[model samples]
Target: MSFGLVNVPVRLFSATENHDVQFRQVHEKDGGRIKYQRICSIDGEEVPYSDIAKGYEAADGQMVILSDEDLGSLPTRTTKEISIEKFVPSEQIDPLLFDKSYYLEPDKTGLKPYVLLRDALEKADRMALVTVSVRSRMTLAVLRVREGVIVLQTLLWADEVRKPEFESLSEETHATQKELAMASSLVDSLSGDYEPDEFEDDYAEAVAKLVETKIEGGDITETPEAKGEESEVVDLLAALQRSVDKAKAAKAGGASSSGASEAAQAAGGSDSGSDGGSDGGASDESDAGKARKTAARKAPAKKSATKKAATKTAAKTTAKTAAKKSTTKKAATKKAS
Candidate 1:
């Protein structure tokens, strides 16, 4: 069934693939089936499933056995329906919160509602946060559209995530103004429209291909050694500038291709309108050329001076606050004496 208000008819399917190599159990010594023993940890005695009981360790090496009835007494929600609690910005949730994904399809009778939900979500540019019970456990998840399909992703609770305190990382110390600027430029250089086909698991694909080749009795050739010495960038500013230049070049290339397509389309339209006359063709060409030039002129600047100025102002303000704190501390010490 489709999920969402837009009700865009969709089938939920997996967006990711799992190609992990699988292994099976084997004999340990005499090439015979190896069996495992179910024994008690404390007594080292074999125990049957019926004879075993769940227990929790307490202080001073004490143990407390828990019965099935005791566990059943604990309150638990049993509903199987996916409960939609709220819709939050996709960015607001951490990527680490996501665990597993499942695709959703529109049921025959629910097609209209499904399509409605899909269209609504797509237009609003929002994601639905829902809770669903699966295998006796309730899970928090997000519902979103991917390639005209509805997908649900299970999320981990906040308590399950470890805090960043263990790393003891100071944001101020690690990210300097110069490094940040360079990193921002690098991000800008690499930024483009999201295309899933552009990325692939190279390692996994290479391994799979190699396995296929080996199965076909093909001989593998030695890989060539990598050449050229790696040079360290001494000038950070120069590196950032170079990255910005590369981004501008890439954008220009994309615009040029788009312009070419528009020109071709205009030529075809003019040819269809007239019986291949030179006057009509020339007029269409002139209009297409002007539109292309206008698009090229609209290209965004590589560096934003306003953003850089704002960062510098923030840094100065922080420095002033620290200086004031130091002065106040000194005045308080003198008064105490």
Candidate 2:
């Protein structure tokens, strides 16, 4: 990495790992793996991987083939250093702009300069906005410290993020202070420090369990889909109040705490058919305990039923108001004619 006259030799390593479960296509009858062949479209013949070359098509239906030598001759192909442009407050960069992250390790000779830069950035509480070339592409990036190590994070171009263009979002809406207070109460009830280690991928675990059950020749019972309790329209204020009540109940070890969770979910959505409920936490508890918890949670379903009725009443009132306005306008126009 280079900053003006100072150069720091460093190595880059990817900072994240994906833990998604992978699957392969196979023949169901014979249990054979499916395979694919690359065939040339012009001649309809199978082509070897060695014969493939990168090609770019233009708007005029012309193909431009690029070879290894042509790519090597490009200015950014052999870039081996990060060029720091300037320092800016870390908050200045939007989290949305962040792409891939890499850990930067200093070379033996660069230790002093690396520490100098890292310490400076830490003390200033800023990030070094820089340009870097990776995989023959020059892109914007930032250098920041993470646990005493200087980390490099790539940024997406400004045009990459799409602008939201929704009519509903364009309209202005206001909330009453009572509603705001209830919402704040709900937020406070659910507030907790974020600890990533406390969470696990429950879906992945379920898939693995299914596979294990099949291997052991055990009967696999399909899980029933959750009923669409969240599909009904709800009164926002009432839902929020119920959610706060539920949170309090849960915190106080009240028997109706489970009902509180459902009320909270209802509060999150409106009559516009928005989804409200979120998936529950990781499946780390024992099956018996899980069953007990699930049984206890049934009270929330009854609580949400009340919101459904409230939503229907609101919808009826809106429909009646629109009908009355239309009727009055038609009568006035007829009388004038």
Candidate 3:
């Protein structure tokens, strides 16, 4: 593609594709492929492919017939060259603007120019805005280097993107200091590096498996509807508290397990020698020590809870004794009188 004074002979490739299972309509009774014939409504007759021609309907319902020759003769820019308008900072473009991505490979002749541009763009941290005609549509796209390959990310027109204006946000909504702090804590607890490989298209996988099972003549089990753990809306504060606690507990549990594993390794390393029995004993003792330390840390809260329960019981008993003594005194005084 020619851009300004620089021309790069690069191969164009699609960045992504769909691997979804496709289904076709079939006659249920005969198990034959079902097809529909294109028919003209006015004549009530089946139409051949050659009889079809593009037509546009006017506002008043008058059809404008467009001949194949007329369409082919129409003036349109079908340029193979991609000319760069300008380069801009990558941050200036919104992520929502990007629609599709395509990888560009450099030819032997364009290798030098392609590498120069790639390295230059990498240092400048910018994307080249360019206009390219693909599939007869003139689209705005960005050129940037990704993993040593030039990737062209096509963008949607400004008019295509919608503004996030909604009725709910018209009025102000605010959170209290404590709620905000708690929410932040919850976020922090769950914060981790995003590994894209960790995710999968579960529904697609299930469908593929279903197809395989049918092909193998195996019994297929109907999938049950997913059920949520929480059945009803809970108090906001309480729910946040539970979420934060669960996250914290999970983190602590993970850390504890990791520490135990490290400790065992360390203990084994120090005690390991000609005697395997000694090493095993040391590792077991190290684990026991960790367990005891964990228990000791939790002991204070448990003791405090037990003490409060005993104090409440004692107070109730003392109040009951005082009431009995007062009643006995009143009866004795009345009898003496």
List runs of model 3 lying over 4 Å from the truth: 41-44, 58-62, 174-178, 218-337
Query: Which of candidates 1 and 2 reaches a greater lDDT?
Result: 2
Pairs in clash, predicted candidate 2: 246-260
Whole-structure CA lDDT of model 2: 0.70
Candidate 1 is scored at a TM of: 0.51
Residue pairs of candidate 3 with colliding backbone atoms: none
Candidate 1 per-residue C-alpha lDDT over 1-337 given as tens digits, one digit per residue, 9 for 90 to 100: 2243433433445667877754435444433434577988889999987898889899988999999999888766686566667778877888999888988876787777777777877877788898877667788888877888667898899999997774556554577899999999999999899887989778777878887888688553343322223323435556899999998767655654544444444434444433333344344444344434443344344535543333334333433343344345445546665
Q: Which tens-of-lDDT digit does each residue in 23-141 have in candidate 3? A: 86755554455668899999999998888989999999999999978888876668877778999999999999998999998899999989898898899999999999888778899
- Where model 1 places Cα greater than 4 Å from the true spot, the runs are 1-17, 24-35, 57-63, 175-337
- lDDT of each residue in 12-128, candidate 2, tens digit only: 999998989998786665555577889999999999899999998999989999999997787774588799999999999999999999999999999999999999999999999
Off by over 4 Å in 2: 40-45, 59-74, 216-337
Per-candidate TM-scores read 0.51, 0.58, 0.58
Candidate 1 lDDT (Cα, whole model)? 0.63
